[model samples]
Target: MKIAIIGTGYVGIVSGTCFSEFGHEVVCIDKDAAKVAALCQGQIPIYEPGLADMVAKNMTGGRLHFTTELSEAVPEADAVFIAVGTPSSRRGDGYADLSYLYQAAKDLAPHLTGYTVVVDKSTVPVGTARQVARVISETNPTADFDMASNPEFLREGAAINDFMRPDRVVIGVENEKAATVLREIYNALYLIETPIVITGIETAELIKYAANAFLAVKISFINEMANICEAVGADAIALAKGIGLDGRIGKKFLHPGPGYGGSCFPKDTVALLRTVQEHGVSARIVEAAVEVNAAQKARMVKKIRDALGGSETGLTIGVLGLTFKPETDDMRESPALTILPALIEKGAKVVAHDPQGMREAAKLLPDSVIYVENPYEVCLGADAIILMTEWNQYRALDFKRVLATMNKPVFVDLRNVYEPNKMRAIGFEYHGNGRGHEKR
Candidate 1:
């Protein structure tokens, strides 16, 4: 099948590369000439694991291509996927801005030569496919194209494996022909008997929002439990483990942390609530989860200050990890983005290190915060150390070396990377979220 994927962000690049790997002639189109040039030159603009290699191999085999001209690419393709970003509107409302998706449909409309399936691969609001269809038909009334919603469930860090071995595939199409095209496109997964849910466009759109909202709920629930455990004399980790063993509870996203901060959850959860509200419905749980996530990020600031004997003013704090999570450089809505600024405002000098996030983090973070290459160097002459994001590089740090250079031996583990007993035995003041400690 000849497929053209518009936009080369995380979703577009990964989807196009993986589709090409499935033996389809896939061309990813982006308006940015520099990004298209970079892809043609084998310089991938984003950092996703195994993506560059797969794109390279597919290009070498003549299965994949990149282009800036959509008019030329769309005419020759059987399917055109709009994988552009649908970021949250800045109007203080939770609506997902669909301008990019609409623009892609308009651009692809005039070039539709035959029966082509225009698929929405971006995480869009409900009824967006219908809107895209309306836009296409309005632009070119003679264009013969069917609109489909095929939401992606790929995680950022583990996108390739997720694309190849998805939990399931959800495709929404209006007719058998469109369904058949989608089925053929995902035939690789069908061979393994992967469950595919064929639904209406609205359901397909809601599934992505619902799934992300639920995960955000789970994260907020655990963080609230961690706060409760701190008040009581119990460990949140053990509590999570005890409940997680139940088949219904299944232990993912149960670990407590600063909060859930990434491209999807923050925007999707809020956008979902916005959609729900538009339909005159109340999503109290999702609403509470969003509030909790915000409070959790703020709580982490107090956690660090409290660890430093009551205030962050006039203190030097060492931070390990800045990305929202390890294995990716994405800093969008990272807890560090929220927490670090507050600390800097309170006059704390922060030096942080991440294996991959520094370049992106430097732009988002306050200039008062210092960035260093070496993780250990972040701890040099610090009053306290914070284990912010749990990168593998920070997991097995030589604490002996860490404590030697710090002005004070205070260690605050925001991600719970270390146990309280171990840090206490090592002759350092240690604070872990929900690990249970007596008042300072």
Candidate 2:
């Protein structure tokens, strides 16, 4: 199978590389000359575990190729996947901007040779697959192509594994031929008994947003429970475990944290809320989840400030991690976005460190917050330390070193990395999530 993956962003690159690994001749087309050149030279822009190795392996085997010309690449391909970015509209309507998708449809229309399955691999709105089909029909009246919505559910850190062995593959297609092509494309995973859910375009589109919204709701629910546990002197972690043990509640995304923030959850939740509002139904729970997550980020500032005995003015605060979650360089909608600003407003200078997010974080964060190379480096000369993202390094830190490095040995573990007694033994004040000031 020859596949042309348009838009060489995270999804496109990962999908194209995986397809090539599956023995398809994949041509990844992107408009950015620098990015295409970088990919051609084995320089991957995004950091996903196992992605570079997969890309390298495919490229070396001559199954994968990168190009800046879609006009040249799209014609020879049997399947053209529009994996472009559909970022949230700036107007805050929660609608994804379909400009890129429409452009790709128009561009690929004239070159649609035979029965080409044009897949909308990007996270798009419900009617987007129809819109793409309509655009293709209008541009090239004789083009024989079927548009399908195949939304990706891969997390940033574990993208390659997710692609290699997805729990299920949902493909929305109108014709039998189109469905057959999709099945063949995913045949490698099919042998492993990965369920292939064939649904309508609208349902498939909704599936992505609905899945993300549910995860966001779960995180927010646990976060709210953490707050209640703090007030009632109960442990949120234990409560989560107790509830999660039930077969109905199978424990995943149940960990209480600062908030749910990344590329997907926040944006998708807002998008779902917008979609429901347009349909005259209020998605109250999801709306509350979004609100709670936002408030949670702001609340983290107060948590750190209280740990330092109420004032942050002229204090040096250390942030152990800056990424939204561990094992990825993505900082989009990270809690640090809100918490760091609050720290700066209160006259506290922040020093942050992450295993991989520093380069990206440097652009978003102010210069006042120094980007350190190591977690222990962030702890040095700090009045109080806050664990923002629970990276593996932050989880198993030398507590003695952390205490020795800081001017004041105060640890505010937002991810509950350590217990109070453990920090106390190391001669440092510790604050775990859902644990009050009495422990500090």
> TM-scores of all models?
0.98, 0.98
Pairs of residues at least 3 apart in sequence or in different chains that clash in candidate 2: none
lDDT of 1 by residue, 1-440 (tens): 99999999999999999999999999999999999999999998878889989999999999999999987689999999999999998787778998998998898899999899999999998999999999999999999889999999988789999999999999998889999999999999999999999998899999999999999999999999999999887788999999899999899999999998889999999998888889999999999999999999999998988888889899999989988988899999999999999999989999999988999998989888898999989989999998988988787888888888989999988888886778888878988888764343
Model 2 TM-score relative to the real fold: 0.98
- Local distance difference test values of all predictions, in order: 0.91, 0.89
Cα lDDT tens digits, model 2, 1-440, are: 99999999999999999999889999999989999999999999998988998899999999999998877778888899999988889887787777998998888889888779999999987888999999999999999888899999999999988998998899998888899999999989888999999998899999998889888889999999988888878888888899999999879988888998888998888888878888898989999999999989888888888889999999999988899999899999988888898889889999988899999999998778898787788888999998888888776787887888889988888998777787888898788887543432
* TM-score of candidate 1 against the unseen true structure: 0.98
Worst 10 residues of 1 by lDDT: 431-440
Error of 2 at 339 (Å): 0.4
Q: List runs of model 1 lying over 4 Å from the truth.
A: 437-440
Q: In model 2, which runs have C-alpha deviations exceeding 4 angstroms?
A: 436-440
Considering every candidate listed, which one attains the maximal TM-score? 1
